[model samples]
Target: MHVLLISQYFLPETGGTTNRVASLAKGLQSKGHDVVVITAKPSHPEGVIWEGYQDDGLVRDEQEGIPTVHTWVYADFEKTLFTRLCSYLSFMCSSVLGAVRERGSFDVILAFSPPLFVGLAGWITARLLNAEFVFDVRDLWPDLAVAMNELNGPVKIGLARWLEHFLYHRADAITAATDGFCESITSITGPDTPVQRVMNGTEPEVFRRDEAGKKLRKEGGFDDRFVVTYAGNIGICQGLDHILEAADRLAEDRSGVLFRFVGSGPVKDDLQREAKRRGLDNVEFHPRVSLDEAAAHMAAADALLVPLADHEIYRSFIPSKLFDSMAAGRPVLLSVDGEARSILEDAEAGRYYPAEDGQELASNIRWMLDHPEACTEMGENGRNYARTHCTREAQAERMTAFLEELIG
Candidate 1:
C-alpha cells in the first residue's frame, strides 16, 4: 500500500506527535509500504527552523527508509492568538500544496491533528488523488482550545465545530489515540462511522538507565536529590502552577524532594515567575532537551510528574510523556483523572494525587520520598507494563494493519 501521512510536526522536532508519525512511517515501511510524510520544515514548540531545514524549497529527506517531504510554514513562538493562527494557517496551506504535488501516488491519506488544519490538507489531497481520507485524532481540536478557554465565543466555537465536523463526515476512517477520543469522535460521526482507538506507543530502549545519563544527572546536581521530573510542554494545559505550589509546600517537610521541570512552552515564563514569587528553591527549571536527553532525565529521577489542568475535558486526554516516564522505570506521581489515571492504577505503576491539589501532590511527593522501596517496586511494575503493552514496534504494526484493513 502507498500511504500519505500529513503531520504539522515531525522529526528534528521531538515530541509525541512527531514520534508517533515517525514510528508509524517506519512501521509501514518495514511492512513493505511506500510511506510519504508531509510536514513543516522542523520548527515547533520553540518556533525556530531546525538546522538543514532552512532551505526555501520543498525540502525532502529520508529517515531510516521512509521518505519525508517538508514545506514552508510560519515558524514563530505562538505567544498570542494571531501568531498561533498564522502558524496554523501557513502550515495548512503549505502542507496542502506539498501533498498535492505528489497527490495521485498514494492509495490512502492520513492526517494527524491539533492544528486541525492538517485534516483539511488531507481531505483536499485525498480528493485530488481519489484516495481514502483518514483522520487521526491526536486530540479533539477546537474542543481542546475551548477547554483551555483558548477559543471562546459562539462565532469561534461554531466555526471550529463546523470545520471539525466537515473532516469527521468526509473521512474514510477515524483513528483516535485514546478510547475517550474514539467515544468523542463517535458521538459526532454517529455509530456508523468507523473509529478505532490506536493509542500511543512507548520506546523502551531509549528510556532505560545509561552511564552517560548517570554522569549528566550528577553534573546537574540531581545525584543527591530525590527528583520528581516533568519533562514536556510547559503549557496552560499542563497546569504546572500546581507543581510549583506543591514544591513550595513541600520545601521543608520533604526537603529531599526536588521538582525538576525539564521543558519549554508559552506558560514557562509565567511558571518561573510564580515559582520565584513563592520563593520556591526546591523547584528547578530547564529548557526543553532532545528526546534522548528527556529520557535520561526521567531515568535519573526517583519519580516522574505528569499533570493536566483541572478541566473535565482533559480527563479524556493522556499526554505521551507519561509513557516515556513509565518506560524509564521512574515511579509516576500522576496528577490526572480519567483514562490516564485508570492506566496508572491498572498497571499499579504509580500513585495518584488529586489534580490541581497542591496538598495532595505534596503528600504524594513525601510518600514516594519516604517509601523508597515501594517507589522502586512501582518503577519496576511500570517498566514491565510499558514493555509488555506499549512497545512502539508492536503498536505500530497494529496501526499498519488497521490502516491496511481500512484502505481495503
Candidate 2:
C-alpha cells in the first residue's frame, strides 16, 4: 500500500501531532507499506526554521525509511489571530503545490486537521489523484478555535463551520483522537461516515523510565524537591496559569515542592513573567527540550501536570501529554474535565482536578506529595495502562488494520 500523509507540522516540531504522524509513517513503512509525508518546514511554537536548516520551497527527506517532502510556510511564531491565519493559509497553499509537483501513485491520502484548511487541500489533492481520503481529526476546528476565542466574527464562524462540514463529508473515512471527537464527527457526517477513534498514544520505547531523569534533577539542584513538571506546549488552551497559581500556593514549601515547566509556546513567556512578579521561587521555567530530554524530564518528575481551560469543546479533547506521562510511569495531576477525567478515572492512572480550579489543583498536588505510596501506585497503574492500551505499537497496529479495511 502507498500512503500519502498531509500535515502542516512534522518532525523537529516536538508536539503530539508531529510525533504521532512520524510514528505512524515509520510504522507503516516497517510493515512493508510505502509511506510519504507532506508537511511544512519545522516552524511550530517557536515559529522559526531549525538553526541549520534553510527555507527551501521544497525538500525531500527520510526518517526510518519513510520518505518525506517538506514545503516552506510561515516562519513567524506570533500568537495573534492574523499571523496564525496567515500561517495556516501559507501552509495550505504551499503544501498543495508541493504535493502536485511530487505526485506519485498513492492508494490512500491521510491528512490531519487542526488548521482545517490543510485538510481541504488534501481532500482536493485526493480527488485529483482518485485516491481514498482519510481525514484524521486531531482537533475539531472552527468550534475549537471559536471556543478558544480565536475566531469571533459571526460571519467567519459560520464560514468555518461550513468548511468543517465540507471536509468531513467529503472524506472517504475519518479517524478521531478521542471518543468525544468521534461522536462529534459522526454527528456532522451522519451515522455511517466510517469514523474510528484512534486515541493519542506514546512511543513506549522512547518514553520509558530512564537514569537521565535523576541526572537532570541532580544537575538542576532539584534532587531533594518533589518535582512537579508540565512537559508540553504552554499555550492558552492549556490553562497553565492555574499551575502557576498552584505554585504560588505552595511557595512556602521551599524544600518539599518545586514546579518545573519544560516546553515552549505562546503563553510561556507571560507565564514566566507572572511567576516572577508573584515572587514564586518554587516555580522554574525551562526551554523546550528534545524528545529524549522531555522523556527524561517526565521520568524525573514526582508527578506530571495536565491542565486545560474550562471549555465545553475541551471536554471532548485529550491532551497527548497524558499518554507521555503514563508511558513514563509518572502519576499525573490532571486539571481537565469531562472525557479526559473519565479516561484517567477509568484507567486509575492519576488524580484529577476541576478545570481552572487552582485550589483543587493545589490540593491534589499536595495530596500526591504527602502520600508517596499512593503516588507510586498511581504511577505504576499509568505505566501498565499505557503498555496495555496507549503504546505506539498498539495504535499503529490498529491504524494499519483500518487502512487494510479501507483498501479492501
Pick out the ten consecutive residues of candidate 1 with the lowest summed lDDT.
Answer: 209-218
In angstroms, how far off is 166's CA in candidate 1?
1.1
The list of candidate 1 runs beyond 4 A from truth reads: none
Give model 1's clash tally.
0
Q: Give the Å error, residue 323, model 2.
A: 0.9
Residue pairs in collision within model 1: none
Query: What TM-score, over all chains together, does every model reach?
Result: 0.97, 0.97
Q: Which residue pairs clash in candidate 2? A: none
lDDT of each residue in 1-408, candidate 1, tens digit only:
999999988886888888888899999989899889999998777778888888888998886566889999887876677788888899888888888886447888999897788899889888988889999998888989998888999998999999999999999899988999998899899988889888887989888965656787789876888888899888888888888878888888778788888988998998889889998899889989988888888877888888888888888987787787889997898888899999898889999887788889888888777788999899999999999988888878988998889877
Candidate 2 structure quality by residue, lDDT tens digits, 1-408:
989999998875777888898888877877899888989888776778775457565878885566878887878877788988888898888887877887568899899998898899889888878889999999989888988889999899999999999998999999989998998888889987799988879887688856888898899888998999999888888888888788888777634888899988888889989998999888888988889888999999999998888888888888888888888888889876787788788888899888888788888888887789999999889888888888877787789889989999
Local distance difference test, each candidate: 0.86, 0.85
